[model samples]
Target: MYEYVRNPSLIHEGPLSKARLPVFLVHDGGGTAFSYHLLDRINRPLWGIENAKLQDGGWWDGGVPAMAAHYIELLGKVMPEGGDILLGGWSMGGLLSLEMAHQIALTAREAKNREGEAGDSGASTPKAPIFRVRGMIFIDSIFPLRLAELVGPLPEEPVFLSAEESRKMKLKDKVNLNMTHARMMVRFWQVPQWKDIPVPPTILMRAKEFVSRDSDENFVDYTRDLRLLGWDQYNEDHGHFIRDLWEVNGHHFSIFDIKYLDDVTRKVRKAADKLDPPDF
Candidate 1:
C-alpha cells in the first residue's frame, strides 16, 4: 500500500512498541535521513522520511505543498490506524513537517464534513481511517519572512557541507541532494503561501550557537524570533497547539553531532512524553 516509498533504504526503523507513539522525522535540506541516527537511542519507534526526490527525481515542480501531500499519503499507510503519531524534522524537514501537519488538518476536517453530510442524507458511506498528528517538533526550521524579519539575517554557510568540505567529500550525489532541497525551500518562501491552518502543539528545539558570525555580532536569535512571531497565538486563539522553545548546545548542524546526542534524545523523549504519555 505504501507505493511511494520505492526506496526502503530511506527509512531507518528503530525499536517498535505499542506502548509509545512512533516518531516520524523528515530529513534536512540535504535530503538525507541518516543525520538523525543519533536519536535512535530514544527507545521509541522512530521512522525517518528520506528525500524521495533523489530516488524519483520528480520533486522540483510542486514545491512544499506537493512534498507534504506525498508524505501525508505515505504516512497514512505506515502509521497505525487511528493512532496519534509525533511528526517532526530538522531544518528544511521541520518546515516540511509543519506544512504536512497543515495539510493533514485540512484533510481531517474534510473527512469529518463528509461523514456529517453522509449521516444527514441517510447515506451509508464507509469511513476512511483518520491520521492524527499528536504534536510537531521543529529542529531549527525556517519560517516565513514575517517571522524571519524579526530574527534579522541568518548565516549563509551550508549546514550540511562547506564548499571545501564538499570537494573533499567527493559525494556529488549528496551535494546535488542538498541543492535540490535548498531550491525547493527557496521556492517555498518566495511568497507567503501558508495561512490560516490550525497548527498542532509544537516544540521548537533551538541551537544555542548562532548560524554565523554576523548573527552573533548582531545578537540575532531564531528562538527569540519565534517567540516574537507569537507562537502562543494558537494557544490563545484555540486553547491548543501551544508552542514551546528549548535551547540546546551547538549550531544548527552541530545539534546532531555526537557530543550532543544525549541532550537531543532527552529533549525529544520529553516532547514525546508530553504528547502521549507512556502506558506504564
Candidate 2:
C-alpha cells in the first residue's frame, strides 16, 4: 500500500479545496506524488498518486499495470460507495490513467455480469459502471505515440541509464523512464483517436520547452495537434518540471520561469470548476 503524508498542521496546505478532489496525478520522471504541491490552492479531496515509481533507473520496467491496479484498489477503498470520480495525471501518470480507465471499464462490465448471474437484482445494481468519470487531464507529459513518431521505433529491450546519470537522476525522477513499454503500447491506438474515450471534457496542459539558442517553431503545431486529438482545452507553458506550490514558476533545463505556472494553474482551476457535477 502507498502511504500518504497527511500532516495535520499541513492539512490546510494541500491542493484539496473541496471535501474531495478525487484527482489522480502522475509526476515527472524525477518527481513524486507530492509534485503537485505547488497547486495547493486547488484543494483536491481525493488524490490517488504514485511518485518516482518509474525512476527505477532500469528504464520502462517500473510496473505500469501494477501501479494502475494499486490506484484502482485505492479508488475502491476511498471513493464514496457507488460514487463517480475524476481521474487525471501528468506525463507518464497521465498515460497510465488512460490505460487504467480502459481497463477499469472492462472490469466493471465483467463484475456486473458476474453479479447478475448470482441473482443480484438488476434494479438495485446498475448495468453500466457504478462510477462514471468526468474527464481526464494531462499535464506536460509525453504521449507514447507522439514520442514514437519523434524517435524511430523504440528498442524492444530495456534501456538502462548509465551509472553516473542514474545517481544524479534519483529513482523518483525516472518513473516510466524506459521507452520499451511505451513503444509496445503506442501501436494500439490509431491517430485522430480521441473519439474512442467515453469520458467528457478532457484537458491537456502541454509545456513548451525553451531550448537555449533554439527556436521552438514546431511547439505551436504540436500543441495544436494535441488539442485536436482529445483535450477539450490545452494550455502551453514554458516549464519542464512540475510547477511548485510554494512558487508558481519552475525551472526548465536550469532556466526558471514563473508566468507559465501562474497561467496554467489558473486554467486548471477553471477547468476543474467546469467538472462540477450537473445540478440534481
Candidate 3:
C-alpha cells in the first residue's frame, strides 16, 4: 500500500451543536468532495473526506479496504466522543460508506470484547461512546461485486461511459492524478464478507434519465433497455439491503445540480432523522 502521513484531510466541519448529529460524506472516483457542501443542512453538520493524493500531490497506494481503515482512524479522532452518524456517498463513495460502516461495527465489536474481559474480573461494561452508523444514502452507487449478478457479465464494449462523460474524460487523461484515482477505483470491486455487522437502513437515489448527445451508439442503445438503469434485478435479488429506491429528478450526473441536489439533501435528512436515535 502507498504510505502517506495523516493526509486524507477532513474538509468540512459543522456547528458544535450536538443537537443533531453530523453526517460524513466521502468522495467519489474523481476524488474531491466539495459537492456535498450543496447538501441541505437543516439540523445536521456535514463533513467531507477526500483523497489526499488527488489534491495534495500524493497517490492512493492501496485498495478500498486500506482506504476504509485509514478514514475510520481519522474519524475516530475527528469525532472522538463518537455517537450515531449518518453516512452518504455519491457513486463510488457509496460503496465506501458501506465499508466504513463495517469498520465502525468492528470497533464496536472490539469494545464489546474488551468489556467482556473486564466483566469476567467483576467490572461492568464500559460506557464510553463510540461511532455508530445510523443510516446510509447511496447516490447511484453500484458495488462491483454485485454488477455481474445484477446485469450478468457485461459485454466486451462495456459501454460504461456516455458521450458527455467520454468528452470530459479525454480532458482528464492529460492529468496523471486523475488516472491514478481511476485506477484506484478498479480495486474496489471485490466483495468482503463483512459478517455479523448489522445492515443499517439505506436509501438509493437514481437518475430519471440516461443519455447524452455524444454518447456511444452502443451506449445509447443500451439506455433503451433502462432496466430502469440496471435496477430491476437489483430490487428483486437484493432489495432487502435498501429500504427505499428513490428515482430522483435528474440523470446520474445532474443529480448534483442545485435544483435536484436540494431534493436529495432534503430526503436524506428526513430519512436520517427517522433512523437516528433521539439526542436525549
RMSD of each: 6.1, 8.1, 7.6
lDDT of 1: 0.65
> Weakest 10 consecutive residues, lDDT, candidate 2?
238-247
Off-target runs (Cα >4 Å) in candidate 1 are 1-18, 56-58, 80-82, 126-128, 146-173, 180-186, 189-197, 214-242
Global lDDT scores for all candidate models: 0.65, 0.47, 0.61
Off by over 4 Å in 3: 1-18, 56-59, 121-129, 146-176, 179-184, 216-239, 277-280
Model 2 spans > 4 angstroms off: 1-21, 29-31, 46-48, 58-67, 77-82, 120-131, 140-143, 152-156, 159-197, 207-259, 277-280
What is residue 159's positional error in candidate 1, in angstroms? 21
lDDT of 3 at 148: 33
Question: What's the distance in Å from true for residue 194, model 1?
Answer: 8.8
Structural similarity to truth (TM-score) of each candidate: 0.74, 0.60, 0.71
Clashes of 3: 3
Looking at model 3, the pairs that clash are 163-214, 163-215, 226-229
User: Across residues 1-280, which tens digit of lDDT does each residue of candidate 1 receive?
Assistant: 2223442223434345445677888877677677776674565766788776644332445676777778876776674354567889887777778777777777788888888998899887765557778898878664544543443343443234455655565445664645455554554454313356556778877777766755532222444455523344534665455467787778776788989888888888787777777775
Candidate 3 C-alpha lDDT tens digits along 177-234 = 4434443444444544455565677777666666575653123224324533453454
Name the best candidate (by lDDT).
1
lDDT at residue 7 of model 1 (Cα atoms): 27
